[model samples]
Target: MTLSFKSLGLSEACVAHLDHLDFKTPTPIQAQAIPHLLSGRDVVGRAQTGTGKTAAFALPMLEQIDVGDRSLQALVLTPTRELALQVYQAIQLFNTDRRLQILTVYGGQSVERQVSRLRKGVQMVVGTPGRVLDLLGRGDLKLDKLNWLVLDEADEMLNMGFIKDVETILNQAPAERQTAFFSATMDPVIRELSAKFLRSPVTVTIDQPKAAPNRINQVAYLIPKGWTKARALQPILELEDPESALIFVRTRRAAAELTRQLQAAGHSVDEYHGDLSQSQRERLLLRFRQRQVRWVVATDIAARGLHVEDLTHVINYDLPDSLESYVHRIGRTGRAGKEGIAISLVHPLDKRKLRDIERHIRQKLEWGTIPTRAEIEARYIDKLKSRVQEALTGERMASFLPIVSQLSEEFEPRMIAAAALQMAYDQTRPSWMRVEPEATDDDRRPSRPSGGGSRTPQTKSRRPKINRVSEPSSPSRS
Candidate 1:
């Protein structure tokens, strides 16, 4: 028999709200943990990301909040601002009662604003460990009356070096309050955290089977002996023309540098990393999701818990250190059973890492040839054809009909149409491609199979600098 949230001890109002939102059944973790949590028992819930664990803890946590008391009765701690925002937003969606108040606090945003909100009597608080500790130390925020505490992503806190800050906040919260711990893995440190804090917690682990990586088409473009990855990327971006993409880099400096280079080439792209302010990060993420920005150059910080709908591509500008991380990065795309593309710009030095990834996945990645100038021009023409068709069907095309008719008298009608198309294509072409340049040797040469490597060592002096429009500014690390 199937179990529902109603059978798991949720009230009618909560069940109706969930049903209205199209949540018909409980996930495995939710089914096991919600009952234990509702009875005031602490929970050590283990589940993978995207397994509905947010709602599993969120529903029960909200159920126990005293809306009438409204003195910051509950606290939710996350490792990053993105996740803090995610949980804050989830609580807002789960709660139907309008009387309850919630606030999210994090770095990069003004601390004064958060202090003001706390002064207004928020019932629930979601925040990052560092900012939460800051506010608590300053006496602007307090957990004296707190009834519940939750540590979401416990393993991530350990990985990010935020465990000490998390412990400080946990030490200050009321000892009598209910506590819960959620993590993807119960590593030794995570287990120790639960052992030290949670009171005889029930363990809930959902078995997540490994997923086959068949849905995503994996391809790698190996940088040639003389060319820089930056120079080689322009033609690839022009050729692929991803609808939306995340280009993963290894460091924040690389992310900013690459973002500047891509922007100079007339691409709608931005940088996302630990460096940017919270408001700036939020704006860029919103723009990327809204399709105003076509791509984002980011570090590994976005590998988990950051979601965008209908993502078309995931590009590895810099390969990750771990094989599992590489798997996780590419898994962001090709979701919902739709075919997605994962492209990697591989240097000759990275062949070993590439091999490791292939061995781990048990499949070979296709070698990608550097797109030639002609191929890109052909793609532009194909895209322009669709635009021409749309323009011909719309009423706006009538204004240019008289000009076409007059030109038809002096020249052949087909020639006149061809001239107009030439003008359109020329005006829309990228500035770098407009000087009638010859295609690179990459187009004529065949790409070697994935294992082939050049024996000659390429020196740094031979490497090309990234073409930048301006100097990059250093943003603070998250």
Candidate 2:
């Protein structure tokens, strides 16, 4: 049965607001938890980062809020500044019509700004643990009158060593206030916090969908270590023809350097890193989202908390620091049921890390062959031919037909086609060029360096590929 927000006992204004926002259906976490929350039960939610958990808690909290009272009615504690900003944005969007003032307080910004916002009187404050505690100590922010408290991404807080601060914040809230906790993974510390803080909370867990988020097709490329990884990536980018792709790198310098090289190679690309000012970072992301830039080269820290929904591709220029980081990187694509693509550039040193990731996820990584030079040229030729065909079929050929007829008078159709092909090849070939063969078969499998000069095989070699396979046939087949 299709369930609606109206059926969940939301007021007509809230339902109308949802319609304006184009939120027609509730996600699983939202569906199961909203009813209990609206009825004023303490709730504990378990879900991953992109599972729509924010709306699940935010909606009920907003519905329960006393708009007439100017005091802080609801307080949401987040682990990081990025997440706090995201949650604050959601509140603003969801409460556009309800006049529910929402403010976010976090580190990485001036305290005077936060104090100013607090003084202006917001009903809800989404803040990081450290900043919230500092505000409390200064007596600039009050939680004595808060009726509801939410701990979001509790697992992240634990990872960041903020559990002590979280406890302090909780102790300040009214003892009778309704409390909720949400996390992607529950550790002993989170469990202990729940026991000590929540009052027999209603626990809700949303099973991860059977497939990876829709439209995201993930494939790993097993290229030889000594060869140019860029050569391997070029064909995949051409084949997929993504509108905008994020290329993930390991370090800030690599992000900048890669962005420059890709731009020089005729791609519209930009670099993102922690070193950029907040406004510059925002503008770079905004440009990518708007398709002004075709590619974004970013490091893990810079890419964290990017909420762009239209991203069509995620390329791991280098493997991530950890399996969890890899998952988070790829999760940026294939969001909201849109088809997305994730490609990784694996090196010899990444074998153990790759195995660890597969073990953690309980799935084998799909291996793909490197694209050959001849194959790349052929694909490029085919694409050029398609564009010529489109140009011949489309409306703007009036001036070209005469020139075509003149050319036809001197050259045969095949010769004319050859001329077109030559122009296309000259135009599309990388300005600085090399024709290197794909690495030898023995070099395809990963290897470890031994104490001696000799290389040690980590895993038993598999049957060699007779042909280089460039792409996965299907999602599950991979």
Candidate 3:
């Protein structure tokens, strides 16, 4: 049966907002969970990432929020600051017309700031477990009036050792209020928690997807021991020229450093990690969604609930420690039946992790050749030619006709066009790329040294075909 957000018991305003965002039908998680949640029943929804679970719980939670009262009426507990901010943003989007007072509290920001907002009378709160528990302990966060409670990514909270803190917050909430638990995995511990805390909750589960290689182009780039991964990424980015990308790194420090390097190289990029305050993170996220920022360097913990449409690539500057995380990181792209690319930067030490990931996904990942200077130049020229063709066919070219006509009176038309093309190429190309002297054949390709021996010029391997994929990146140690 066809089910829309409206048919699933969402408010008209919420339905209108969803419609504006081009949502036509409710995802399975939403279809099953929203109705029960709207009817004031507790819900335990089991769904993997990218299943529209946020809307499933958020719509009903907003519907019940007593916005006029100005007292905190709803509390959402996420496992990380990123998820908390994401949930808070989702609710704000739903309540855009209402301008409901909702505040997001988590660690790292000044507690006094959160307290100040709390005192100002917020109708809803979304926060991480530890920070929320700390606020609850201060007596400033009163759940005596909280009417709706939600635990987003409950299983992740357990994995992060936040279950105790989550339990504490849940215990303090009014028992008479409606509750919901949304988790990717309903493990024994999570099930146990729900059984103990929830009151006859409705359970809904969405099946895990099959192996991921079917939609995402998974490739691994082995950075040679002599060269840093950061240096190698330049050619890769130039060759790929991704429209949007998330470059994942292991630590907050790495995220910042990598972002700095990328920005210095004139790339459209920024860093996102736990170290940034909430307001800063919100501004960056807004810019990223609006396509003003083409790329973001983020840590896994800081990018939990980050979602973007038609992401072109996901680059792992550093491979993840766990197989599940590797899958989850790449899964951010290639969504909704669209194809995406996944790039992993690895050293010899990372073979085991790579092997485990391949085994888990039930497919072999292709080896990406770190693009040579020649390949990058070729791609640039190809793109420029394509752009020129587009311009020739477009009305925008009408604006440039006067310059071309004036130049034609002094020079051959072909020479005038060549000069104009050269200007365009030189203006767009980076000075470093153009000024470097031509390199030896071996130097052209960024690869491991060839066993300290000279080889015949005819013995070169064919370059891999260009197939671009997309998602968030993880950074390398270097």
Candidate 4:
């Protein structure tokens, strides 16, 4: 049976607001945690990042706030600026009546402006530890009357080395305030932190859906020796041809460079990182969600809080620094009970890292060979065939029948059809396939494959065929 917010003890106004936002049924975490939180009890919630945990804590806290008093009654501390902004925006949506003055305080913006807003009065503030502590130290933010404190993504805070700062902030808040701690994993340190801070907290653990592995087909492509990862990725993208994907990179420079390379290769791609302004990030996200951009290369920090439905793929252009990061990156896909694909490109040097990830997830990744030139060509031909079949039955076929008949009078019908297919293939095929450099001896290795321990095969190198058609003279339609 489905549960509603009203049955979960939310006020009529809060329930009505949820309806306005189209939030009819409560998620598992929200359904379980709301009761404890509404009764003014400290709570510890264990769940994954995209499991609707934000609303579970935010809704009850908003309901408990005394909007008439307004002096920073609630404080939510997040690990990254992106998450802080996301939480602030979510709360703003819930505050449909605008009864509370909420503010988001984080770095990368004018301190004077934040201070000006804080002085005017804010009932709630969502911010990062560094900037929040800075404001507290400068007497710009006060929490003497604070009634609720939420430690979001607690494990991420520890991973980012913010535990000390978190503790400092926790010590300054009212000792009797209601505290809620949420983390994806309950490691020893997180447990110790909760014990030291939360007062008789009620623990709530929502197991990750059992269908995660079944929903996402996880695989890895082994990069041949001496070949740059970028080169290996070209064939993989051509073969898989994801509808919409998130390509995870290691740094801002890598994100920018890879996006530039992919764009130059005629793919609809973009770069997303902290270097982009908030407005720029928002625009890129809008484009991605609207399917205007097919792929986005982004650093982990900047990609947090990004939720896109029916995402076709998650490509790890660079392996994450930690196992938790890997989980978070892949979790962006395989959501909404939809099946998706998660692919990783593994270099020879990163064998141990791949093994560590496998052990962490406790699932062996299917080892996939890089698509040969012949295989890519076959896939392209298959795609062309499918398009031709669709166009034959489509309404627009009548418009093109006259042109085909005109050409048929001068050339054989089979020759004309072949020429049309060639033209269409040339326009739609990737540019790299036409001019890929021949593989040298250095690109081959005699050693066993990484992680899977399979012997590498030896084969003679061959050059790719150059099609007769040149690059398209005009922007090709999708």
Candidate closest to the true structure, highest TM-score: 1
Scored against the true structure, residue 198 in model 1 reaches a CA lDDT of 85
1-478 in candidate 3: lDDT tens per residue? 6777888878788788889988889888999999998898999998778778888988887777666798889888998877787777777776654658888898878999999999989888989888888888897899998898899998778877899888888888888998899987778999998999999988998765554647888878777556677876776888788899999889887888778777777889999987778788878988998999999999888788787888879999888876767877898889987999998887888878888888887777777667755566777788889989999999888998899888888999999888888888888865446665544454444454232222112224433322212222434432
Order of quality (lDDT) = 4, 1, 3, 2
Residue 441: error of model 3 in Å? 5.8
What does candidate 1's lDDT look like per residue over 357-439, in tens digits?
88777777877767666667778999889999999899998898899888888899899889889999998877766765444
How much lDDT does each candidate structure score? Answer: 0.81, 0.76, 0.80, 0.83
TM-score of each candidate structure, all chains considered together: 0.85, 0.82, 0.82, 0.84
Better of 2 and 4 by TM-score: 4
lDDT of 4 by residue, 1-478 (tens): 6799999999998899889878899888999999999999999999877778889999898887888886899999998877888899888888755669988888887889999999989999999999999999999999899999999999989877899999999999999899999998888999999999999999999875341356778888777665567877876787899999999888887887778778877889999987888778878988999999999988887887776778999999888877878888888888767888999988878878988998877778877766656667889999999999999899998998899898988999899999989999888887767676566765433233645533223344343432222211212111
lDDT of 4 at 357: 92
Model 2 segments beyond 4 Å from truth?
96-98, 209-215, 228-241, 405-409, 412-421, 432-478
Q: Per-residue lDDT for 1-478 in model 2, tens only? A: 8999988888898999998889989888889989999998899998766878899888888787888887898999987666788888888888844567788887768899989888888899999899999999999999878999999988778877899999999988899989999987788999999999999899999876432454566667755655556656665565556787888877777776667666655778898877777668768867877888888888766565676767888998788766667777777787777778887777677768777776665555556555434444666678888888998888997877787788998899788878877987778854432334345656444442322222122444432222222221111100
What lDDT does model 2 reach? 0.76
